[model samples]
Structures are given as C-alpha cells and as structure tokens.
Target chain A: MIGRPTAIALIAVGVVLTATAMVLPWYSTAYGGGVEVVVRAWGTEIVNKPGDWPAGELSPWYGVPVAVTAALLVAGIWVARAAVAGAAGQAGAVGVTAALVVSERGHAVEQQGDFAVGFGLVFLVAGTLVALAGAVAVQREAG
Target chain B: MKKVLSVVLLVLAAGAAAGATLLPFSELLISLAPGQPQTAYVTTGWSTRFGGTKDEHGPLFGIPIVVAAAAVLVGVRWRKVAFAGAAALAGVAGMLFVHLLNVISFHEAGNIAIDPGLEAGFGNGIWVLIGAVVLAFGAVVVHPDD
Candidate 1:
C-alpha cells in the first residue's frame, strides 16, 4: 500500500511543476535558414512575453497545459480529502499532461528542425511523473 | 431530480462533443512570406484524411466523448453507472488532452510544407468539449446512480 507521505509528496511535486510551467516559456523558435529577418512570434496566456505573433489568436485550447496544470494542483489538494475521487482527477491530469508533452515533443523532433523544448514542457514532464506517482499511491491506498 | 440533472449533464456533454466535431480543431498557417499566410481548417473526420493534412487526433477523442455521453444517458439507472460515467468522462478528458498534444505537434512540425516558419494551434471547440466533460464527470461523481 502507498503511504500518505508518498502520496503527499507526489501531489506536492505535481503542484509545484504545474505552477512553475504556468509562468515559464512554452515555445521558442530557432531559425536555421539564411533569412535574416526580424521574425516575430506568439505567446500563450501563462507565457505572456511580447513575441512576434499575437498570443491567444489561434484558439482557447492552446492554453490547455496551463489549464491541466491548474487542475492537477486542485487534484493534489483534493487527494488529501478523498483518495478515490482525487485519484480520478489525478488520472485525468496525468493522461492529458502526457499527451500534450508527447505530441509537442514529436512535433519538435520531427517537424521543427530548429526547435527547442521550453520550460513549460519541462514542467509538464515533472508534473506527469508526480501525477503517475500519485495515481499509484491512490491505488495502493485502495488495495 | 438527481436523475434529471444527470440526464441534463450527459446531454450537454454529448452536445458539446457534437459541437466540437463541427468546429475547427486546429488552424494551420503556411506562411512563406510576411503577408501571405495560407490557412487551412482541420476538422474531426474524413476531411483530415485529405487536403495535405495528417490528423489522427480528433476521432481519437471525439468518438469516446460521444460514446461515453450516450452510455451515461442510457445507463444512468445502473448501480455502477456513476463510476462508469466518471471513468468515461475522465477518459474523454484524457483523450482531448492527447488531442491537444497532437495539435501542437502538428503545428510545431508544420512539416507538411517545407516552410521554415510553421504556425499551428487549436480551435475553441476543444475547450468546449473538455469543459463539458468535466461538468459531466462532476455531475456523475456528485450523484452516482442517479
């Protein structure tokens, strides 16, 4: 069975990572071509730095990582009150976080020749780990 | 009253899922130049198969959301329906999350055209579906077996 300490620890780590990602940069560009142009970029809600492209122009779902991170934080807090219910929330967080990271990473590796993984991504990885640990803890508690 | 609420939630969730399908999931812009931005709409079905798009993401999440909503509506009287509904809703959330990932990658890679600058992002429909799934999950959790 999972210990309360372990569960709390996982939740705590997830909370911190998700929170950190909210403020960190999500994406950046690395131009390889010999085009010497002052290219502008876009930013997201959490990473609201003045980039070339206007932020929030694409869609609302672009801020999903932030939303999911916030939800993970809430799930971490809820676990203390109810393991079963909290487990559900944590599972959702883990699944979504993993999906977002994997897809983005795939794109970076495959599509973007001069792409860099951002802090938001790092936080997503950390949060996913914590969420997985928390899920295991909940299962252990139940078993 | 609880059953009615559950039905309403399920219906809303299903409606949102349907709406999500109708809405554009992502916008792909192939900007070869500063003002010449070619935009394309990525939907959830057969359209994605063609039109220089490779999106295997939408249906992955869309089908489940619709199926789960239907299940919840039809089986609300079951003893474990609440748990089932919760699981389904959660599953929908997870899939949608993955869907976003696919979108990011699609945009990130922007490899369809050998363009240096590839711009991609999700549409509003996804958030609507995700929010509806959360609401439906909450409703099930609050009153299971309704």
Candidate 2:
C-alpha cells in the first residue's frame, strides 16, 4: 500500500514531469528545408518539435492548463494518501489530462507535423498510468 | 431532503453546463457581427481560438458541466439512467468543447487554408439541445416532488 509520503512524492514527481512537459518545449518555428524548429528540454533545436499548441505560438501562456492539471494531480494524490478518495477526483484529473492530450492532437492536424501527436500520446499514456496508480493506491488503503 | 437537494444540485449543474456552452466567445462575436460576411471568417477564427477546430477544449469544459447536471437529474428522477446518461453527455461535451476551441483559434490566426468541414465534430449545438431537454424534464420531475 502507498503511504502518505509516498503518495505525495509520486504526485510531486508527476507534477514536476508534467510541468517540464509543458515548459520544456517552449517554442517551435518552421524554417523550411525540412528543419523543424522546437524548444527542447535541453535546448532549442531545428528538428523535432515537441507538441501541438492549439492556441498557437502567440499564446504560450496556454500552458496554464498544464499547470492546472499538475495541481489537480497533486490534489488527487493528496486525497488518495489521506484515505479520503473518491472516483470523482480521480476521474476528473484523468479526464482533464486525456482531454488536453486529445485537444493537442487535434491542433496538430493542421501543422502536419508528428511532434504534437507524439507528445500528446505521451501525455495521454502518462495521465492514464498516473490515474491507474492513484486508483490502485486508494483502493488498497480503503480496503 | 437528500433527494430534493440532489435534484436541485443536478439541475444547477446542467444549467451551468448549458450556460458555458451557449455562451462561447464565438457566440459573442457572432452577435456582435450581426449579419456580416466576416461572420464566417470570424466564426472559423473563433472555433480555432477556443480549440474547437481540432483540440476540443471548449467542448471539454462543457462536458463535465453537462454530465454533472445529467447525473444529478437522473439520480433524482431515475437513479439507474442517471449514471450512463451523465457519463456519456459529459464525455461528448468535453470532446466537442476541445475541438471547438482548436477550430476557433486556428482561424483567428489567419489559417484560412484550414478546412471548415470539421465544424460539426465539436458537438456544441447538440449539447445545448440536450441540456435544454434535460432542463425541461428536470423541471417537470422536480416540481411534482416539491
């Protein structure tokens, strides 16, 4: 069974990773020559843009949603750790993450670049994994 | 007392969902335009901005609102039906909202080359209809109890 600190730590890690996912790929620009300009976790590059931002480059502040999702994940983890868990909170966090990932993919459709699709899928998978783990932990504690 | 409160909660939730979806930023623009050619272009832009075009953010926001509403209503009026209806409505609403936002943002950015054919995908108009029906039914069901 996941203890309180362990649950909190997992949530913290998830939040940090999610935040990195949002902030790392800060920008993307296409300069022809098949060179895809993108901001990576390590540095900016001329290849492999990370994800699709439906709001577009003008509104990088849209990363607010990612931050919010991270907060929700944290809350879910806390609730689960405290043994005050419910399907609503867990479902809500998972739903939001899944929605965001799907939305990102939709936005990437116009760009015809694979970067958004790749990152979106990653987020979806990550969110699902986190949700499952949280649910399992909560169930174990509840039982 | 619990039953009454549950019904009230459901109705409120549905109403909130309806309000959000019905009051999209695009609707604001369309009302402001009031019969202009730019309406089409503006709508496209609005759709993209809100992620309606591809992302479905707009629909996503609306879904939970609708689901919570439906769940409350069904839970009160017909307990068994409440869960499935609520879940389905919420999921559909969420997906559509996201797509709508994507479309609005895309068009707004002068991405005119983007096809407007995916307009129906977001499901904004449909959810509004569903919400309205739920509201009407909920009123009838709750009034008798009161």
Candidate 3:
C-alpha cells in the first residue's frame, strides 16, 4: 500500500482532474456557421434547425456525481469512518463515469457518424482511477 | 431507526430519479430564427437525441436510480456502504441543479439564432432531483454507527 501522504496527494490530484473535466466540453463540433461546444456537465445549445445539424450530447448530469464525490473524497480521506465513505464515494464516482464512457461508445457504434467523445472524458476516467486508488490506499491504512 | 431512514432516503432518491426521467427536464420558450417562438418542454431523455444527434446522458440516470433502489433493499445494515450510495445520489442530483444554472441561454448555428429564453422555467423534475439529493444526504447524516 502507498503512504498516507501519497494517498492524500492522489486524491487531491484526482479532484483537480475531475473538476477540470467537469468544466471542459463533453462534446463539441466546428462547422461553417461557427464552432459549437457542449459540456454535458453543464452546457448545450439548442438552436432550432430542421433535421440533422450534425451534433450530439450527453446529459450534464453525468458530470455532477463524479465531480462532487471526487471533490468530497479529498476531505473524507483524513478520517477512518470518513475514509470508508470516501472509498464508497470514489467507487460510485468511478462507476458513473465508466457507465458514461460505455454509453458514449454505444452511441458512437450504433449511430452512423463521427460521434466524437470529448477529451475531458480521458481526464475524467484517469482522475477517477487515481482517486479510487487513493481511496483504496487510505482504506488500507485505516483498516 | 437507521434502517428505516436509510430505506426512506434511498426510496426518495429513486423517486426523484423516476421523476427526473419521466418529467420534462426543462421548459423553454425556444426562439429560433425563421420560426415563431414556441414554448416547449425537453424531457430528461433530451428531446434533441431523437433528432439529428443523440444524447447519452438522459438514459444514464437509470444507473444511479438502480443503485439507489438496490441500496434501499440492502438497508443501512451496511451503514458505510449505504451512506456512500446516498452520498453519490446527492452529488449527482445536486449537480443537475448546478448544471441548470450553468445552462447556455443563447447561441447561433451558422447565422441562425437559437435562443432559449434566459428565464427558461425550472421544471418540477429538477426540483425533485434537488429534493432527492437533500434526502439522500440526510440519510448519510442519520446513519447510525456500526
């Protein structure tokens, strides 16, 4: 198992990455009209246009739990009882993120187009993995 | 008391997720160029998904809802585990509200203006989600020591 400081540092880094992912665009597209970006954690533009305008989105809801839980895990890492909660929270956040990734992959495969998943997702999954590892570390030390 | 509270919170979370999915995600007075402004509601499934593009987020709500429901069945007998589930539910639901505030009101697609009014009404479903988060958190706080 890793040292306590390293574990804490990992959680902190995870929080930073997850928080960054939350703000970054989950999906985006550039076209002749202009560049349009949608952050499923928060923003999407609904312009009335007839038929396939060539853009897609995921719910901003996906970003919420992953971010919030990961952020909280940073603090929760300190105490034994809280560490368990932190571990659970980390697991939940990772689970949700993984589901989001899978769901996006599903859409890309089913639909016939270039449904690009955003770069933020890479940060998100990595952050969750790091955070989960940190949580596990903390749990190991506590136990 | 702990078990009952845990069940209540988990059930409430599930209830909120159900509402979030079934009810309109947002009520909007969408104004796009070339057409008269029309009031419309977008469901959690994100109505736009059916159109040119698709949304993966709307359907993803099922995961948490399922987790919450399963947690309810498990009871707080596993207090920490239950609390974690509750905490997760709260995080996700609360953030949906946060997302609402961060929503984009106006944008242009190629020269056409797509403006959902700045004051697009917050739908009932969103409020329920907020409520779910609170209840879920309450369960975490009320959870008894093992």
Candidate 4:
C-alpha cells in the first residue's frame, strides 16, 4: 500500500503543477507582421490579435483547476479527513480535465497556426493525474 | 480505542448519508396535467442541465444504503465481525458514490461547453454522499478486527 507521506507528496506535486500552469499561462501565438500578444485572463491564454484569435478556447473554465488545487490544500490542512479531501480533490481535478478535453475537441475541427495548447494544458493533465495517483494511494493504504 | 473511533466515525457518516437521502439531489418540473408549474425533488442524484442530463432518473439507490446503515449499527456490536460490517458499509457507500458520478456528463460538443449552474447541476445531497463514502472507508480501515 502507498504510504501517507507518499500520498501527500503526490498531492503537493499536483498542486504545484496546477498552480504554476494557472498563474503563469503564456500560451503564445504569432499574428500578422511579427506581432505576438498572449494575454492571461483568469488562467486562459487569449491571443490578442485583430479579427484573428485561436478557436480552442478553454476560457473561464480554465480557473477551475487552480481553484481545485487551493481547495485541496485547505482540505488537507483543516476541517477534513485528508483521505476524504484527497478523493474529492481528485474528482475535482478530473472534472476540470474533462471540461478542458471537451473544450479542446470542440475546436479541433479547424487547424490554424494561431491555435496552440502548450505547456499549460500539459501541466494541467499531468497535475490532475498526479492528484489521482495520490487519492488511489490513500485508497490502497486503507485496503 | 480503534473500534470506538471507527464506530463514532461510522455513526457520523451513516447519519449524514441517511439525512441526505431525504434532501433533493436534483430538482425537476413535475406537471400534473398541463401548464401547471410544479417542482419535484429526487433523492437519487443526477445532473439536470449540462451535458444533456435531466433531473429525473433512477430512484432505487437508497436500498443498499439502508442495509449498510443497519449493518453498521447492529453488526458492529460483535467485535469478531465488526470488520465485516464496516466493509459492507464501505462497499455499499462506495458503489452509490460511483453511481452518482453520472449526474454530470462530458463530451465534445459543437461549441465550448458551459459549466452548469448550482440549481441545474449537482446538489448538496450528492456531495454529502461522496464525503460519507470516505468516512465509511475510514471505518473499514480502522475497525478493530482489521
């Protein structure tokens, strides 16, 4: 069974990844005539170009992952059984990931150069999977 | 000491789960005949708006929970079989939690999917159920026989 320390460490790792991705989302894109502008709104990277923006917009929903991470921290520290909090955190992370997946797929129909889902999305998925690993660890330890 | 703590946690969990059963997991518009606005509450949780889900769905999830609660209350008295009772409760609660996950659906749509609002999505009943599963698991792990 995975130990408690290991589980906490995994959850921490997930938090760091998710927080970093959310706080410093710089998914960039190049517009006409060597202009590059990517603005961070909540957690989504918006390509600020006139009449030309990326189709894959995980906007508004982007903040959910970071919020979930913060909630996990609170759950682990105060007013909750760590195991229970971890399980809920995993579910929250997975829900965010699912939302992102659908958002990505719905816009994947048109391939354009201005569209890019870079390290931010990668980190989000990785962070969610890592948190899930932590929750599974708690489950196994109990078993 | 472990048995005491386990039973305490189990009682808390079971009580919460039982209480939540009477609460509305999702709300729906129930029409008696036509054009009459009537709202009905459903105990079994399911997503009502997002991902093409509805408030009305299967309502038979309360049976196993009742049996699990009874087992925890009565079966846990016997120290020799306390672990079995805890395990049973955990199993039943865990399965119900799993089944309730379908309240929200996910898929690729033509446009970016919007997040469901409080009234249209999961209610407090399902949240309590999820937490109860975790507590039930705690009871299972810390049982004296285990």
Misplaced by over 4 Å in model 3 are A1-13, A19-26, A32-71, A80-115, A140-143, B31-39, B45-60, B68-75, B104-119
lDDT of 2 at B15: 64
TM-score each candidate: 0.49, 0.46, 0.64, 0.40
Candidate 1 per-residue lDDT over residues B1-146, each given as its tens digit: 87677667766765675667556666665655556666564655222532465654323334545555565555456524444445545555654655555556645654544456766777676677677667667566555553
Model 3 chain A scores worst on lDDT over the 10 consecutive residues at: A28-37
Error at A58, model 2, angstroms: 1.4
DockQ of 4: 0.02
Instruction: Give candidate 1 regions above 4 Å deviation.
Output: A23-29, A33-112, A135-143, B1-23, B26-40, B45-131, B138-146
Better of 3 and 4 by TM-score: 3
lDDT of 1: 0.53
Best by DockQ: 3
Give the candidate order by descending lDDT.
3, 1, 4, 2
Cα lDDT computed for each candidate against the true fold: 0.53, 0.43, 0.56, 0.49
Q: Is candidate 2 or candidate 4 better by lDDT?
A: 4
Task: Rank the candidate models, highest TM-score first.
Answer: 3, 1, 2, 4
State model 3's lDDT: 0.56
What tens-digit string does per-residue lDDT give for candidate 1 at A37-100? Answer: 1111123332333444332233324344345444644664445324333334444444443444
Off by over 4 Å in 2: A1-10, A26-57, A72-128, A135-143, B18-36, B40-146
iRMS of candidate 1, Å: 7.2
Q: For model 2, what is the alpha-carbon lDDT of residue A6? A: 65
Better of 1 and 3 by DockQ: 3
Error of 1 at B87 (Å): 9.1
Q: Which prediction has more favorable lDDT, 2 or 3?
A: 3
Candidate topping TM-score: 3
